[model samples]
Target: MIRCDAHMHTRFSEDSDASVHSMLDAAIERGMEAVCITDHLDKDFPQTPDFPAGAFLFDLGNYFQRLTQLKEEYQKKLEVRIGVEIGLQPHLGEYYKELTEKYPFDFVIGSVHLIHGQDPYYRGFFEGRSDEEAYHEAFEVTIENLKKINSFDSLGHLDYVVRYGTHQAEEYSYRKYADEIDEILKHLISHGKGLEMNMAGMKYGLGFPNPHPDVIRRYRELGGEIVTIGADAHRPEHVAFDFDKAGEILISCGFSYYAEFKGRKPIFKRIVP
Candidate 1:
């Protein structure tokens, strides 16, 4: 299969379990054509920048060093790409901008993992906030963050609230939030930002694909041409999970092809199963 999983995470990310070698090995074993290692970098993880969440121990120097060595080591076996997942908070834009300026990433994902300073990975975040409030904040924060940092390529998991919210996918379809969704798609389209097809929704049993296929179609309807499918895999087992389904969603979303990056520029290819 000719496939690329652009959003896999490694142990460098706070919640991930796979290592760079482990993820790449899984991709090679699965016969994937390419893969990107996009570990998380949120400055608020304590003492870094505007984030007080404590410093994350993600070592970029080592990451690049090892990636360079591994790319050379595995070039004939598999193509490994360098990427980073930056958590977007309005307060941390400048830091991220400066950081990316110094690092040449093949892919950069802008995701909203926290709302109002709390991560939804924890349970209580879905408790105190109403479903509407939670969903609204998620969308608003994503839009606000994207607006602030227009430099990134793809907008990650636009419907991520469903993964951790009080509501399920059946209750959280495109019709319920069309206006805001349109605004987001239009903004991204205007800025030429691609959307990410994160298959983690299916992996987590969220019923629909991440961002919901309907929303993806709407994005295409609003002139969105570029997209990147990511399993958002934190473990080897999750790598390229549901990739066929992601491609199907893209085709139905009016996209004839999907994109992968090298040297921070897009190279589009038709979705092949």
Candidate 2:
């Protein structure tokens, strides 16, 4: 079983109302060995008139203060790691670089949640574009960000666009974007960065991980080794969702080990049959 949940959000994340203490209690109840509080930190966020500005940005001082208190409080029962999930954009690459450098984070998950100043979460982004066009454009932007930045530890939810695509993920497959996907994987491998096996797809009813099983297999075949398991949980109950199934998926993809990070270094743990 994957013992550590490396991606989670708390009250610090604008999208979530869960507190750090409540989440820690839930992780303990589920028998988790470790949990990382990776709250959202999306800089230069394109705020809509309705969305307002700096909504996703969290106070670093308050975040660390709460983290330090919780780490000390739960140090005996569960291990807590300080982490951040950075929303990558072409123009904010340098901003994230300085952010990561300024903080002492255990892990960083780089994710692309927007394209052309719009998010796929809303239907309007996919209104005129074909699902194929939308998905491909998202991947293209991912490649652009990956090339421009090298500060994050792993790429979060590689095929994130498919989760919210108008037609859903039924029409998506790795074969359709093999070249672009390969380029992304090659960039990660070259930089010694990792990939995250995000289980949020199950919650979204996609019946697979963010990148799909074939994409994970291809990542392994391309000599990519570092992989972390996370439910991408924003609430207490969502932590470590379908982790056993995630292990099965990893083993089927020829990954005998999943990764855990401390001080920004990956330590692989063997997957048992």
Candidate 3:
């Protein structure tokens, strides 16, 4: 089993109400070896009716203080790693670099939650364009952001746009976007970055994880080795959700290990057969 759930959010993130203690308790109950609290840090996030200005931002001072205390309290039971999930935009490269360096984060997850200054989560993003076009645009923007951001351990939920796409995964497949996806995989591999296998795709009823099993296989075939398992959970119950299936998917995808991070470096652990 993939014992370390490398991605999760707590009350530190504006979107979640689950406390850090609640999440850690859930991880312990599930018998996980480690969990990373990668709260959101999307600078200059576009404001919407439901999300206002600074909605994706958090107070780093308070976050670090509370987590530092909890990390030690739980050290004997479960490993708690400090992390942040940064929303990648071309303009925020240097900003994120400075923020990452200023803090002592154990891991960082770089994700593209917006495309062209608009969030794909809303139905409006898919309007005036075909689903295929919108999906392609997301991948294109992801490539652009990847080129700009360099202070991340793994790319989170590589096909995140698909979760909100109209018709969702019905019109999505790695083969459909091989040219762009291949370039993305190659870029990550060449940069010593890792891909995240997020289980939240299943929670969203996609029937498969983000990037799909085919993408994972293709990543391996391209000589990419580092992959991390994450539930992308915002609630206690969702912590490590569908992790068993995650292990099966990793094994089937030709991965013998999953990655965990400490002090911004990867530590691979074997997946027992």
Candidate 4:
């Protein structure tokens, strides 16, 4: 079983209302070994009706202060690690590098949440293009951002755009974008970065995890070994959502172990059968 949920959020994330204490308690109740509080740090997030200017930003001082105390408070019953999920944009590479260096993070997830200054969560991002065009552009931009940044431990959700697509994975596949997708996988592998198998795909009703089972298998086939499991949970109940299936998926993909992080380095834990 995958007991370590490497990605989660709380009120500090700006998008979540769940407090840090509630989230840790829920993880302990479920017998989780470790949970990383990877709140959002999406600089320059575009303002929207639901998400106004700086909606995804948070105060780092308060975040670490609270989490540091809780990390000690929960040390006996559970392991709470400090982490951050950074939204990657090509121009923000240096800014993220400095931010990451200044903080004592146990893990960092580099993700692509915006494409061309527009979030795909909004309909405006897809208004003038076919789903294929939109998806292609997202991947292209992901490649650009990945090429520019190297401060994160894992890439958050390789196919995050599919979650907001018109059909939402009905027409998505690794084979469809094999060339671009392979480039992404190869880059991560060559750089020693990991890929996150975000279970939020199932939570979002995509019928599969982000990047799909095929992509996970392909990553292994190409000699990529680091894969982190996460629920991307924003609330207490969502912690480790669908994680039982996470081990099964990793096993089927030829991964005998999943990754956990401490001090920004990956530790491989065996997946018990």
Maximum-lDDT candidate: 3
RMSD of each: 2.7, 1.1, 0.8, 0.9
Clashes of each: 6, 0, 0, 0
Q: Write the per-residue lDDT of candidate 4 for residues 108-185, one digit (tens) a residue.
A: 999999999998978888899878888899999999999999989999999999988988886788999889899999
Q: Give a tens-digit lDDT track for model 2, residues 158-236.
A: 9999999887876688999998999999999999999999999989999998779898899899999999888998989
Task: Report the lDDT tens digits of candidate 3 across residue range 216-262.
Answer: 99999999999988999999999999987888899999999988999
Ordered from best to worst lDDT, the candidate numbers read: 3, 4, 2, 1
Candidate 2, 200: how far from true, in Å? 0.4
Lowest-lDDT window of 10 residues in candidate 1?
46-55
- Misplaced by over 4 Å in model 1 are 46-52, 55-57
Candidate 2 vs candidate 4: the TM-score winner is 4
Query: What TM value does model 4 have?
Result: 0.98
lDDT of 3 at 128: 95
* Residue 56 lDDT (model 2): 83
Candidate 2 vs candidate 4: the lDDT winner is 4
What value of lDDT does candidate 2 attain over all alpha carbons? 0.89
Model 1, residue 95: distance off in Å is 0.8
- The true-versus-predicted C-alpha distance at residue 269 of model 3, in Å, is 0.5
Error of 2 at 244 (Å): 1.9
